[model samples]
Target: MHAPPAPPEADMLRDALELAPDARVRPLSREPLGSGSVTGLEVTDPRGTAEPGTRTTGVTYFVDTSRRAVERETGFATGPSEAPDARVWLHPADPHLPALAPVAFADAASVLLARLGLAQSGPPVFVAYRPGRRGVVRVPTATGDAWIKVLPPSRIAQIVGIHSAFAHAGIPLPAIHGWSQDGLLVLAPAAGAPVAEALGDAEALLDEVDALRRRIAAVAVTHEARTGLKRRLDWYASRLGEYDAAFGALERRVRAAWREAAPTTVIHGDLHFGQLFQDDDGRLTGVIDVDTAGIGVPADDTAAFLAHAVASAVLTPAPRDGQVWALARAALRRWDDEAGRAQGFRARAATHLLGHALGAAEMREDERAAALLRAAASVIDQPAGTLGAT
Candidate 1:
């Protein structure tokens, strides 16, 4: 069994507004409290119990740079309505769980039911919400009706940009009717199964992803201003340096990247299976989470795609949904063949591999970290690739 966290950890260290000036405290539950699971304790005054009246459903708490991490595992939850303070809440389940949010707001997901008016209601289930990227919710819309989405793009210009690309491609994606700067997005749910559950074979999924890629390519912005050679090297070095001490050789590797001549292109910076939606009949319907779509090196898209590709491999039990090396190679090959960049895919893939490698090292799974390092090592020795060898 895994060891328990230390005592007095309290989990939370500080609050943004000092608990909004002490009138509130970051709500948290300890391991001992909830069957060894640290759930957020959303309470009312005087008494607490989990009943229909006392039980709060359809609520989630978001913990980011902005909110306090009251508990190590769970953070602040959304009350009946969105708020910044500790108040009485009646949340059905945690929004941190994918399907929880969708289920909670099933009544409010008005646009979804109307769009698929003819279809049967898919009881969308909540799979594990991938932590680092976004909380994903998988629902059954029709036979496979479902949707997968990131909260929103507040850090960068990701969501709006991708939504526009969907429109340009004539692809049917979720309609972004409501969005907040903090990444809270209220989108029109898609009618399909999560590609994760719908597709039976990786080969078929890859083909669908490839076709989807080409369609998006039509509307891709080609005139993106490339950073000059000197500027590029400096930028690489600066970020590498900032990350080097933690990464070991990243700083040195970035310094050498200055000499490489890599081309750039437009891509959905992050794309893969998780962003995809498929019908129960195996028809891939819509792909959401396109904000990372932008003009960058071709390999950037490949790396992002492979990130999900690798994740799929880890998530699936039997014959895995995909393998990292094969999927990455295929995505790269397609970018080079149809997208017009010969070396761009290789260079960007190498760059993405490095970034993903560093982050992967911190994962709890030793094998995952090892695999990421091995793949990244293949490219790291290339001037700009100086992070380290696996």
Candidate 2:
């Protein structure tokens, strides 16, 4: 059963801080971080949205400079005072999320340590960034790393789906071991460079993920076979009759355009520059995270790309000024060459336009979505034939 909603002020970090023997509870910053900040979901995620759940760990450590204080602050150091077969450790956050206070602080601290290459491994290497407590962990064993990713046994099917999809596609993603009884998904060792750090060597990295994506696409079922949930256009249209109507109209136009182009395989739902990872030796190692993996109109992913490009564009009315074409061309090359040359430049082109149009409209991005619609509208009025035409 799904967990019930939590209280709006359920301050897990403050509670953990108060519970900790020596750690100090610092209040959060009054100003909240913006939506598009480099900070991750932990900071961005507001409190009360989280369900009440406790993860299991045989050990916990409090990070500090003084050994005696660390021992005192971190709990269960081989004494009778330790809970029956349970141990607690005092873990401190280096830079807490000021808006969310203690939790953010701990999360930031952990991320800093991970990026710096500290506690990258331990026996049961699990890193839970819930609220408060620890800042980074360098586990001693791979076993711990595996335990860190434990998931539910029922979701093994989803795990199996991701694993088989990777194997069939011949991509190198994290391996999925069976889940422990506690429902945590055990995973094989992951060794790769973070995608953000790999940006300097983009050309090579793009080629790598492109090849991997095709392999993924190869095993993908067609759109007709993958119905229900929400179609590319339907997602936009459904929201049209609600809080806004622009989204629905845009969805209709994008749908018409999509029908003119045929889609063949499933595309990675969130494929982008940040998704790729590499090894220390500069080898492109794996594609991480495929929970949204499924057969989709390539244009769906394409739309997300366009959204990012436009949103990040330095100038407005990019299409008129020719910048849109320039960026689109670059994205097309990556989609074409790196994306395994799927042979649908014309259809994909139309879909790309449609994707952006529909998305902007749905988002009620009044000006941008309208502009995209006008761009498509300016070029053609009626779609000529059944989709997937040459």
Runs in model 2 lying further than 4 Å from the true structure: 1-155, 168-170, 177-183, 188-190, 201-205, 217-232, 240-249, 260-269, 279-283, 294-329, 333-390
TM-score of 1: 0.50
| Residue 149 in candidate 1, Cα distance off native in Å | 4.7
**Which tens-of-lDDT digit does each residue in 85-199 have in candidate 1?**
2211223333333233443355544454455452436544445343323554455555343544444243324556667666877876887644444444545666587776544
- In model 1, state the lDDT of residue 131: 31
Error of 1 at 298 (Å): 2.9
lDDT of all the models against the reference? 0.44, 0.39
Tens-place lDDT digits, model 2, residues 1-390: 011232122233334323323333222211111111011111222222233443212222222211121212233322243212122233332122111222123353244334434343423222444222212122343233432332323344564566676667677767754433323333455557765453444346546655766677876433232222233334334333343444445445544534333455776665654456777665667775554567665654554443333333312433443443334335545554333224332333433444455445433455665555444443223231211111
RMSD of 1: 10.3
Model 1 worst lDDT run, 10 consecutive residues: 29-38
